[model samples]
Structure formats: structure tokens, C-alpha cells
Target: MGSSSSPSGGGGGGNGSEKEGNSSRPRFFNKKEKSICWAKAETVPGRHPERWRKDAADNVVCKRLFNCLGCLCFEYDHIIPYSKGGESVAENCQILQSRVNRFKANKDEVDTTQLKGYSCDIKFTDKELDIIEMAVYGDVIRPGNQCRCRTVAEMLGKYKSKDSTAACKLPQSSESL
Candidate 1:
């Protein structure tokens, strides 16, 4: 939050030549790094450095969250999970309903080793389905259904265009459950 009166003052050259050790100019500063954090100081006429900036692509929905039927509003939620080595990108984030987000968060806190069938469909073996009548239920309870509502269908339609391969696949039937 410090400011200097001189344009070439001792703090550091906000605008200086980067020709190695040309002068007493601070060696640490660079033009690109300065641009990223540079903000207008309210008290003065000079630029102040900041830690965060508004994203240029703020209008674009995160692809992964969009695919999961998430609205572009609010912070995105990681799908595969950052704890499991997922990266922080739109492609990895899934939009979740508030109720579902709460349920998943609570579920994560509990040990489900004794809670049989908690694994659900995606994890269930196709072979296991062949032997059980309830396997049909497993196939329907998709991870995608967490955001069940009209929003889900609308978002799914937009996402379907980009993910054409999955477009024809029928939604897992939730009627029986």
C-alpha cells in the first residue's frame, strides 16, 4: 500500500527497461506481472498492484459444470474432485443443486463401507446387473441426476450439442425409484 512521488523513485521501476543490470532499477519486477495486478489507486493517480482480477472470459460457463447441468452463477464445484487429482477448470467442475451439494458433503463425512449399494450405478459392474433385477435401478441413479429439475433439462440440452455422443443415450429412468 506504499506510494512514491517520483516516477523513477527508489521503490521499483513500474516502467523501466529490462536490459539485465542496466541500472539500480529493481531486478524482480516485470511488465507482464505488473499488468496482471495493476489497479488504479483511489488515493493517488498511480496504479496499485492487486492479487486478483476479474476474468476476461467471465461470460463463458465452465464446460464440466455446464455438462453436469450447473448454472454459470456462483463458484464452480469440482466434479471428479480436486482431492482425487482433478484440476481447477470449468471442464472439471459440475454444477450442483444446493440440496445435492449438501447431501454429497454430508455423505463424504460418513463411512459408507457398511452401507451396501451406496456405490450406485456408475460403479456397479455390468456383470452384477446381469444377475440382479435391481441392477436396472442402478443404471438410472446417475451422478448427473443430482440437479433434478427443469434447469437440468435445459442445461443438458445446451451441453448435449457439444457432447453429441451422449445425446442419444436415454436418461436413467428415475420413475421406479
Candidate 2:
């Protein structure tokens, strides 16, 4: 099977064009966003950082295992899920092994409470947190001449600091009557 390709064409390798085609495809995350997510996942408290350590020759090797059960490999995932309006910002993104990402695909939310012995606390900037709250909990309803709404922080019973409130605004349906 492999020798047939070399014998038939043999000029430029078929693999070269295939690589170029793949390079033209759009990536889910840009370079900067990917680097940020990778950095954040590296600080998950109990995860093995050594998995990404540089080798003796100063080259880094990917040592990520299959899923949440193993060590870290780099696969970026959306914490809030894109289908649920989660933006591709750093806060909404996370790094998981390929298997873990596949297992968690497209779920609206991840129930971290059930993950025993795993202490997971992902840090988010105030603005990112606000966006998450709005996306997950903010509600808009038009009642007669006015629109009624509640912020995600309010629904979650968490107090929203004045700074956080002012930093992000909920989507306005019709000029907050």
C-alpha cells in the first residue's frame, strides 16, 4: 500500500499537499488564545506539571495521557460550550487531554461537583466572569412597555461588586425601559 504511491507518482510527495491543505483549515483557537489556555491549564493545582517538562536536550515532549484519568496533553476546550454561547475568550477556554474533550463535547455545563478528589478552580478575570454569568444566567423578558431582567450573579445568589457590574453590561433588548 505504501510503496504503490512512491512508484506511481514519485515527484512531490503526496503527503506534502495533504499538509498544506490541513494548514489552510481554520483553527478553533488562535495562537495567542491557545497559549493563554495552555498556561492556565498548567496551573490546575494538582495536575502533573512534569508531563510537559523539557527533555535533556531542551526539547519539550507532549506527555498527556488519554483523558482526565491521565497526565496532561494539550487540547483546548470551552468551559461553557460554544453551542451555549460561550465565546472563545481565555476564561471560557480550558486545556484537556483529547479524550477528556471528546467525552465532554458540547455539554451546556460541566458538573465539577461530582469529580471526587480533584480540586478544580479555574481563575477568571472580572470581565470574563461577568460574561459567563450573563451567558449562563441573564434573562430578558418584555412585559408590556418595559423589559425585565436579572443578572447571572443575582440568579446564582452571588453578590456582584460595583466594579464587575460596570465592567460588563447585559445584552439590551430594547433600551432597558
Candidate 3:
């Protein structure tokens, strides 16, 4: 053996450091964490009418819903507000929170609705964003693991705050498209 500066006792620097690495592996998220993720993932699928199918297909549907996309039930969301000349087609419909849909009240909210009558790209609320983030990240363990869910929103918000023309013209559907 090579000349040892310190013996391999409890005070041994090399041995102590090496032993630290052998400690029990860290546990993954506990049951509560899993439940929260599952709930967040399924929120949209269970609530929205038009989006339920897509949400189910995207694995955002709750496990209670047959755990299959085909079995998911959906409803209609007005892509273009009836007041603003929107259609009720699947392409135009979306899965939205009941509260959100009610808030809009069968008409377009100028601030939330796009000018050209496309509601597919929605302005998400914080709760909605949380679910989107969870779905994209597959579990929120670290900030470094953040997904691209809000990147476009952040960029758009930033550009709009600065009144940047480039960002203003960016197509709204691009976020999910």
C-alpha cells in the first residue's frame, strides 16, 4: 500500500468522505406529493368540455376516468366568443375551468380573448399554470427542472410590458402549437 498520511479510522479524511457517499439514497416524493401531482395533472381533463379528450390523450385526465383517453368526457369552450363571432367546432372549442368559462359568461372578455377569435391559446391563471407546469415537468422537485410551459407567456408578458412590437405581433396560438 502507498504511504498513508492518516490511518483509516473514524478520523480518516479519505475514508469518512468516501463513506458519506454510501449513505441511504434519498427518498422520492412521498404519497402526498404523488397525490398532488396526480390531482394537478387531472384538473383540466375533468373540468373542460372540449379539452377533455385532448387532456385525456395527453395523460392529464384523472385516473378515475377509466385511465384512458377514449373514456374521458369533454364539453365545449368558445374559441371565438359568441359575441365576437366565434364558432363551436372542436378546433374552436377548448377545455376550460367552469369558473373561468362562467367568468367569461358566454361572451368574450376583451382582455382574455384574442382579437382574431382563437381561444385555443388561453391566458392561463396561476392555478392553471401550476397544473401546466406540473404536467410539463412531471413533478416539481427543483427549479432547475422547470419546463417550457410558461416560457412563451413570460416572454410575451415581458415584451408587452416593454411595448415591444415584435412580441405584440407574435401569434397567440404559438404557445401550445
Candidate 4:
């Protein structure tokens, strides 16, 4: 039998501030914890198994979308809320869509309805999804003929402009080539 003291367990720290060298629970999950959390959830097909995971709301979240402020993005969340005495560990971690996470804030909730209410309703085709992956991450998970959609830019040549703000420069149309 061991003894433990909870800051919230009918007691208060003097002045709520004290010199406790490295005693505070970690505010974030370590890489190993994150991996464990991801593995515990259902996997998705895109990219790699570890790159995608189902959020608490059951929405597919991509690690590539880390810190993004919308759907399909995710942030590591404290399942029990650190402020509410949750420890930072794999057992206490989850990935939630950015919007759902922000809305959830510090509340320890498992309500699928509340979480889903904040998710986006947009549906995307696989090629559009690949385009987004390219735009945001500069790499595509699906390559070659596997993805049937073609970019108008495809019939057109690849961009030659160096400046991002400059208009996309494609070589003269095939008729001129």
C-alpha cells in the first residue's frame, strides 16, 4: 500500500505555487506514448499505419495535419484532461480532430455527438485528397495511375515559376510545342 496526494483531492497547495523541481506532470505525450495511443486505435489506408489514426470522435485524423485548425487534422489530447488530474501517458492520450479538440478544451468528455457536431461535412474524392496532401505536405500518398484523377495542370506542363505568388507558368500548349 502506497500513499498519493492529489492536488485536487480535498487539499490545496500553499498559494498554489511552490518550488517543486520537475514535479509537474508532463503537458504532452512523448513519442512512445503517441505511438502507443495510435496503435490502440483503428488504422487507415493512406500513407502509413502510424501516420493515420481514428480520433476520439471516430473521425480519421492524419498526423501530417498536426496543428492544423480544421477537419482531418489532429492534436494530441489528454483523455482525462491534465487539469483534472490526468497524467500524461499512453493510457491517458488520444488524438482528436483539431476543431473537436479546441471545442473540447479541458473538459473530460466522451460524447460522440458533441465531438462530431464540430466536424466538417465536406466529402472528398481520392484524387482531391491526394491534391490536398500535395498542397499541404508537398507529397502525395497515392502515386502513378493508381489515382485516376488528373490535374488540368497535368495536360499543362509543370510550373516553372520560382516565386510562389507568381502565376503558375506552364510551357506553351501542346499545339505550340
Q: Top lDDT: which candidate number?
A: 4
Q: Which is the better candidate, 1 or 2, if ranked by TM-score? A: 2
Maximum-TM-score candidate? 4
What lDDT, from 0 to 1, does candidate 2 have? 0.38
For all candidates, the clash counts are: 0, 2, 3, 0
Q: Model-by-model lDDT, in order?
A: 0.26, 0.38, 0.31, 0.59
List, residue by residue over 1-177, the lDDT tens digit for candidate 4. 000123331111122223234766555566677678778877765544545567877787777776666678777777787667776677887777777777777787558898888877765555555556556654444423222223557448763434333232222456321
| lDDT of model 2 at position 127 | 36
Per-residue lDDT of candidate 1, residues 21-138 (tens digit): 4444332234443332223111111111121111112122211121132222112233444334433333433323222332333122322232222222232232222222122221
User: Which pairs of residues have clashing backbones in candidate 4?
Assistant: none
Worst 10 residues of 2 by lDDT: 1-10
| Candidate 3 Cα deviation (angstroms), residue 114 | 13
TM-score of each: 0.19, 0.36, 0.23, 0.63
Model 2 misses residue 139 by how many Å?
A: 53
Off by over 4 Å in 2: 1-27, 44-72, 113-177
Root-mean-square deviation per candidate? 20.9, 19.7, 24.2, 10.4
> How would you encode candidate 2's per-residue C-alpha lDDT over 4-96 as one tens digit per residue?
112321111122223213354222445566566556553322222433422111212233321223222234566766445555556776655
lDDT score, candidate 3, position 99 = 29
Clashes of 4: 0
